[model samples]
Target: MSLRRLLLVAIALTFSFLSSFVLATPLHIIAAENFYADVAKQVGGEYVSVSSILSNPDDNPHLFEASPTIAKSIAQAKIAIYSGIGYDSWMSKLLAGHSHLTIIDVASLIGRQDGDNPHIWYDPHTMLTFALAIKQQLIRLDPAHQASYQHNWQQFVASMHPILTDIDSLRQRYAGTEVTATEPVFGYMFAELGFKVRNLGFQMAVMNDTEPSISQMKGLHNDLIEHKVAFLLYNLQVSDPMTEQLKTLAQTHKVAIVGATETMPKGIHYQQWLKQELDAVQKVLKK
Candidate 1:
């Protein structure tokens, strides 16, 4: 071949390689919670790469303040997933100028209005919805990988069957069981399992990071003394004097105590962390 013809062929091959590289690059995603990060990974599979802003297992997601770094992440991400429901209001503020990115507000997709509990992951049904929504969004971004995303989601749904079964069993075993928490972190899960939450005021106080009113504290004390609650659930991350007082009262009144964490600790997978939490609840409630 002539030198000119050889140069043209080489250029064509280089352009083809560059096109393949561009097409194969993973879709960038930013997830608000660690739990959603796991779900995003499963649903997106190899076609998407995810970064969770609140990754520290010890950090209370409610108390997280957004920084410039997080803002940059949000600006560059093609898809952003947030728990919403007023839980991560900072996310909305950060996303205001980014009109090109597709935002998946989990709360909106799940039909939660303002003041609704944002811990949707604890509800298996809600999680199923989240997974489906994620799969659909990912397919829209990369149609070539639709089959892979759907397949992975189907497997995820199947894998979660046991968790759903366990939830049902818990509901059957602990129906009408009275529980109290420092915050509403686990209220949705408790409600799903048929447990009556008796300390909503106290939990809401802690969730909002404010001192409970004297009346609210007095009411919680009364519930403890009157044996109105069967168990006390506390978030491990937040340090609340009221929760500490309640812990002491729980021990004195023989009320079971269960600690719940928002993040899955290092070295523990999503399923294992959830199973551990459910086991703690089962053991405490069974007593």
Candidate 2:
């Protein structure tokens, strides 16, 4: 072949190979909690490679310590997600130097403040919001897969319809039903279902790692013993002697208990996790 023709052919082949490789590369996503990771996966589908920092159900998110490995992952990620408002504050510090990353703070997206309950995943709407944000960011990051991202977002939104319907159905059927929690982990869901949550002081204290006031403790005990609360949504991820005592009191009074978690448990999708918890609540109400 002529030298000029050979050079042109080689350049064309090189460009083609580079284009294919770039197209096949998935967007790297890092979520502080598994639930957010799960949502990003659902929304990004095969176009993303997701990693979750907090995947264990037993770990306390409040006590999360960021390591060099985690910092490296954050630095490498094209997209990052975390619940702000003090839930995963460490993530913010780690993310500070990674200004190039597209950080999605769920608390900030949902306008939740510092004192607000940070378990934003329990609220279906929060996931919906995050899913949309993920979709937008993915589209921006990989415009070639814009259609795929949109389709995934639509499917995710469609999937939540049943959960929303279930919430409405439960609210209509059991609105004003009394419920309590060891912590406010599932408070948003409880409120959405129209359950009258008692012992706010107690829940806040436990969530903040402070001791509940004597009156708050007395109120929680009385509510369980008197059957004033129909169920106790306990934070199974964390437990001290005090929370364990409350659990015993609930069991003694026959108050149904549903365990809630800060992170999405292993072997479950985000939608499944929410549905399972809602189903648990419904079962308690049925009983």
Candidate 3:
């Protein structure tokens, strides 16, 4: 073959290989909440592009309304994740008509039903299960990347070991200990630590943004004022007059107040977020 012809043939083969690599585009993944988006990213790695619909730590997630841009994103995504059981119902509405997308409802994935706390991600198991689910879904969606997904998922699961150890240590020392929260945002974590959560009715009412019966208010107030609970868990993203009143009482009575946010803060991944919260718990308990 002539030298020029041989060089041209080699160039054509290289172009074909490059075109094939470009064809394996990253999957578009949308998560209703930021933490789930972080998990999807951890498991999906370079194979996926993830978006979090509700990512602000200061915004009250209960009052969130979907924007047109968010809706369009969900419609075009290859996988959509939401905390089902009513946490982000707007996601369910936005996800409709896209039957081709894979949906991961963390609540239903773990057998939780409506009326259960929507913040199931607070439990380590919930996130681990979610990571595994994302891995499987990605494997099915792109079998070519199955090994990558499996390795990433394993690392994600292993990263939670320290958090699990913290949970066990807390449970050993504070199991059956009395605690209270302004809402149920950290209820699952409390359960994992085996604490007896007090004034749950008050919490549910606050979470739903409804009036907790005067008696419910009085019950929580009395718990705080009387120091019946070891610490008060308040939602940092959400606070009302009622929440403030209880927070004041907690402080005055010397009961520690632990603030928990509804969404993961920016620049911090899910694992770091959980570790910080667990550290706060340990701090309050040791006080």
Candidate 4:
């Protein structure tokens, strides 16, 4: 071949390789919660890069303040997932100028209106629905990997089978067992396991960062002292002096206490995180 033809051939090959690289670039995703980020990772597999803002298991997610770094992340994300029942309201503010992002508000997907429990991930059903929605969004972004996304979602569903079994077992053994919470962090899961939650007014008060009514406080105290509640579901992420006092009271009264967190801990998959929590509840029940 002539020198000119050889150069043209080299250019064509380079262009072809660049096209493939562009096609293979990972989809950028941002989830407000770490669990959602984990779900996105499971569904997206090798085809995505996910960022979670409220993922530090150590910090109180309710006190999460917005920053320029997080805002920039949302601005550049191709897809953004958030629990939108006022859980991560900061995300909405950050996304105001980021209209290009495909937003998956999990609360809206479940028709969970305001005033509903914000801890939607605690509900197994909600997570399943979230996985499906995430897979659909991944397909929209990367149709070439649709099969992979579908397969991963199916695997996620399969993994839940065991957790569902655990839930059933707990329901049989501890259903109708009364529980109280510092906040409603584990309310949905408790309901799923057929445990009755008492002192909702106090839980809601704690969640809202407000003082519970004198009557509500007295009711909780009396319930704990009288052993009306079998367990105390404590919000480990947002505990304060008041919550600590309540926990001490419960401990003194010999009530089992199970701690719940707002975010997925480091290096644990979503299914494992949930199973560990359920296991804790089971242990408490056995005690």
Reference-based lDDT, each prediction: 0.83, 0.89, 0.90, 0.89
**Candidate 4's C-alpha lDDT?**
0.89
Best by TM-score: 4
Q: List TM-scores for all candidates, in order.
A: 0.89, 0.92, 0.91, 0.92
Number of the top lDDT candidate = 3
Worst 10 residues of 4 by lDDT: 54-63
Error of 3 at 9 (Å): 17
| 1-287: candidate 1 lDDT, tens digit per residue | 99999999999999999999887778989988878888888888888888888889777787789889988878768999898888888888888989988898988888999877777777767778989998999898888889999999998898888877888999997899887887887877897889888868777777777888899888788887888888788887766676687789988988778998876666665666677888899997777
Instruction: Report lDDT (Cα) of residue 220, candidate 3.
Output: 88
Report how far off residue 19 is in candidate 1 (Å): 5.1
Candidate 4 residue runs with Cα over 4 Å from true position? 1-21
**Model 1: CA > 4 A from native:** 1-20
Ranking by lDDT: 3, 4, 2, 1
Taking all chains together, the TM-score of candidate 3 against the true structure is 0.91
* Model 4, C-alpha of 147: deviation from truth (Å): 1.2
Report how far off residue 263 is in candidate 3 (Å).
Answer: 0.8
Q: Which stretches of candidate 3 lie over 4 Å from their true place?
A: 1-24
In terms of lDDT, which candidate is stronger, 3 or 4? 3
